[model samples]
Target: MTDDTETDSDSDSNPNQNESTDKQLISGWHGRYYEDFDVGDVYKHPFGRTVTETDNVWLTNVTMNLNPMHFNEAYAAETEFGERLVDGTFVIALAVGMSVIDVSVNATANLGYDNIRHHNPVFHGDTVFAESEVVSKRELESRDHVGIVETELRAYNQHGDLVLSLERTPMVLKRSHAEPSAAEPPGWPEGIGTQPEDC
Candidate 1:
């Protein structure tokens, strides 16, 4: 005679069963590895960011940009733009930031940027969106587990005008080499102290 019902000891015997259940419970956007990309594939990033007057003024001052067109409304009104123009660097930074979730979330390092061109001026209250196309990819000769992916990034304003464009390269890990455990939150180490006094 034999019992078909699974017992506690039977479940405990297979440690992977628990891990499988945990993986199923934890589900969301995990980002892409090197193998997930293909040349010419374009990704339209999900969110749009609105540039405000405060944003232009703060970034200009924080970076020590002495341009009046970025912060001084009175001075900017005298220029051909007739109003304050958002910092070009700020527009570039925002475009790159928006693409990170779709292109470089799993990347180990950003190789560099190239061919940056600002086509149109950005102003306050303008909403910006970004999209990226995988331009090229190649496996590293020295590092077998790592590969380089180059993408062409483009930014557009609310009216669909091209505001900026650039190409960037990122060093990404291959799916075969990436650590699966990294996807899960780490547990507290046994010997590590949680309280400041214990340290």
Candidate 2:
């Protein structure tokens, strides 16, 4: 069997080297705010998650789903699919989780989900990818620091088959309110919290 794991050579060579360097440390992606969205813009989320039998079984069990088709192999084999099917609700949850980085990482609240539809069955070992398109956005007259943004979310299997789709509305913070410093912890003086001994 081939090992497919990737490694960074620089980090492997001198992991502590970065701590001594004076290079400006830039913040990583915190996701987009309200002004970053535009109607008709499509965001193809970069990550894909492979669903496994364990994933389906565990989620179904935890959620107290009594459906035989999801866990009982013998029962599922007798069904039309002839195999276990991943729970539909798990797929929906996974799809929404996959879209968070691009669609609602900065959202203060998820307004609601609408038009949720499951088009096909998701089976174990199927890798799922998500994409979202900005459907509409509007400023809220009642709130100056936040706005509503609607997006059409879609999920596809490894073979590019659409498995799930839905519309999500999130109340995202406006750029004016999402200041760069807002990423820092509240009420903790910046320099005072760095050393572990300070605690």
Q: What do the candidate models score in CA lDDT, each in turn?
A: 0.86, 0.88
Positional deviation of residue 137's Cα in model 1 after best superposition, in angstroms: 0.3
* Tens digits of lDDT, candidate 2, 1-199: 1232234655577779768654333445768989999999999999899999999999999999999999999999999999999999999999999999888888999999999999999999999999999999999899999999999999999999999999999999887886745324323455542333332
Cand. 2 Cα-lDDT: 0.88
Task: Kindly report which residue stretches of model 2 are placed more than 4 angstroms away from their true locations once superposed.
Answer: 1-20, 181-199
Residue pairs in clash, model 2: none
Runs in model 1 with CA error above 4 Å?
1-24, 181-199
lDDT of 1 by residue, 1-199 (tens): 1344467567778868755432223334657789999999999999899999889988999999998989888998999999999999999999999998888877889999999999999999999999999999999889988899999999999999999999999998887876544224123343443333332
Please provide TM-scores, in order, for all candidate models, with all chains considered together. 0.79, 0.82
**lDDT (Cα, 0-100) at 168 in candidate 1:** 90
**Using alpha carbons, what is the TM-score of model 1?**
0.79
